[model samples]
Target: MNFKSIITSFSFTIVFAIYTINSQNTIGETEVFTTTNQAVGNITFTDTGDLVYSHHPFFSPENRVMIMDAKTKTSKPFPNKAWNTPRTTDDNYLSNVLGIRNDENGIVWMLDMAQRDHVTPKIVGWNTKTNQLERIYYLPKSVVPKHAQPNDMVVDTKNGYFIIADEGIGNGGDGTNAAFIIVDMKTGKTRRLLEGTRTTLPENTPTVINGKHLAVNGTDLLVGNDGITADANFEYIYYGPLNGTKIYRIKTLDLVNEDFTVTELDGKIETYSEKPNNGGMSIDIAGNIYLTALETNSVAVVLAKDKSVKTMVKDANMVWPDGVSYNHVDGYMYVSAAQVNKGAVFNDGKDLSTKPFYIFRFKPITKGVSFR
Candidate 1:
């Protein structure tokens, strides 16, 4: 009796351990790579592996952008302090920024919303390799209308263009005015397309986090045309609203062509896949689009072939994951936990965000564009 009982107990314990190991493996590995005091808006990596990120303007941080040392974890105003300092006169300082990406040439491109100082919205590019200001392309009223919030962008150096998603909720307008803004790098010409289209506008449903609907002053949050990304080949642009349930993509060729009218371009958009209310997105070489599933506190992937949505990883602390950027140096994807839902605007004028915001990283199924 003693020998048989001992043998059976040992086997049961071994099988239980194996089952536990397998269950943990299916969830994947996520590391808390960095922590910061300021709520981060977005993040990208330079060729040298330095971490660069935007200080979300919603909280009115002292600096608009900062660069951190990978090993030391020290932070400094990116480019220099002057670029972040504000002046009464019109200057080159970044007013407010949310979108940022690193190009193949090592240029850290920042999308400055210009909401703080009432200046023109613009894209500021800082070359990391050369350590100088590369360029700044201002968006006129025609290209970026009033109440337009140019939140995120995809830089397609392969196609010689930069595309920005205007959420159209900057000051007070609803999500109906949301659209896409295309910039011609060579000529600096810009055009607004698909304004008020179904693909660009947010779903009428409120973005409910946990069990409560996000709201400010009595109006439910209506973020539009938020997360956006382009394929590695720059063939198609994929995007959806922050309060959306479906993702959409359009051919790059049809988007840039002047021949297509507004109605024609609207027809060219294809419903790519279903998704949860997400913040930022990045696409891999294999066409897997990684999205930050805000409602579920997880990262989801939309497969390229069949377009099935799957949860890749989850973390209870990763609230309101705002940005996803691929790091070519480490072959991992970095994501920022913006914690926007904890901000005062959403919580009856009381900021509930905890100190020391977190940045997480995990290995992707395949390699992705570092510049995205």
Candidate 2:
């Protein structure tokens, strides 16, 4: 795909960096798009190669969701302009969107946290092929606690289920609570698991970015369970806390089985590997897990064959890489640098984010799990 020069000022620097990175064959980083609006939270590419991204509502309240043409690099409100606009009377409008995934079946699944305007949390599915609303599922207050901050999600298209992660940072930014949620797409039934469990909660670890601790109100903001992904075959769901280093997984069958007691499901949980403080993650068809190392501004991979971790790509410009999506058609992994650590929340109430936030792509050795 040809990337447009959204901001020509950085063209020379970006091209030189890409050429330098490509010469090494470690990983080739390319800037696909740039924006001066709200920082990008999460992104996914449709079957037709159109990019869908969420403007994290943590900083701005507009353009909650958007669709960008891969070739022209022009974006517009997704689904429709009405859904993106904020309305007090309309309950169907998107309030705050973060996690998004486009399945192989031409469906774009969006996870709305509803943290803004006190709207109800919801999941909306849009058919990319038909350009129609496929389904909408609302989460009751019983499952979404007032303190919960639902962020990332993984869709199991074959089984009609989605697993979401609640960082539980709470409205006050205290990262003490966390949970794993399972939603049945067919019935719209949702269940919360491992609520406030040791496995789900954040560790007493500080989030250091570029050798500096990220803090708010004189306290380190250690986010809880944030990144999540499923294996290529959907056999197991893997996730880890943003403030923690240990990765965990459980069989999909065990998680979807309503008859299984919490204890039984806990027994099925398996500790996978000890990783760095990370943001988003994606798995390859070979079962290798690609993770964004937030502190180092690099992508790390956990080998499926041996479970050993290795740094795949390191770029100085990938500041606070928050989300990653692997595109099979282009043979590249797309990443968003949200610069959360540089936001007002961490910069003493001053937003230090550089203008024209970036979306980058790099080629991975193996094909992505979603590749067909």
Against the true structure, whose lDDT is highest?
1
Provide the overall lDDT of each model, using Cα atoms, as 2-decimal numbers.
0.88, 0.82
**Residues 218-261 of candidate 2: C-alpha lDDT, one tens digit per residue:** 88888888899998888888998998978999888887889988
Q: Candidate 1 local accuracy as lDDT?
A: 0.88
Best by TM-score: 1
TM-score of candidate 2 to 2 decimals: 0.90
User: Which regions of candidate 1 fall more than 4 Å away from where they truly are?
Assistant: 1-27
Per-residue lDDT tens digits of candidate 1, residues 1-372? Answer: 599999977875675355335435333457799899999989998897888999988899999999999889999999789999999877689999999999989999999999898888899999999899999998989988887899999998988998999998988878888989999999899999888888889997688888988887888888889999998888999999988999999998889888998888888989989998888999988798999988877888887768888777778788888899998998989988889999998888899999889999887766777688
Over 4 Å off in model 2, which ranges?
A: 1-37
Query: RMSD in Å for candidate 1, one decimal?
Result: 7.5
Provide the global lDDT of candidate 2 against the true structure: 0.82
Q: For every model in order, what is the number of clashing pairs? A: 0, 0
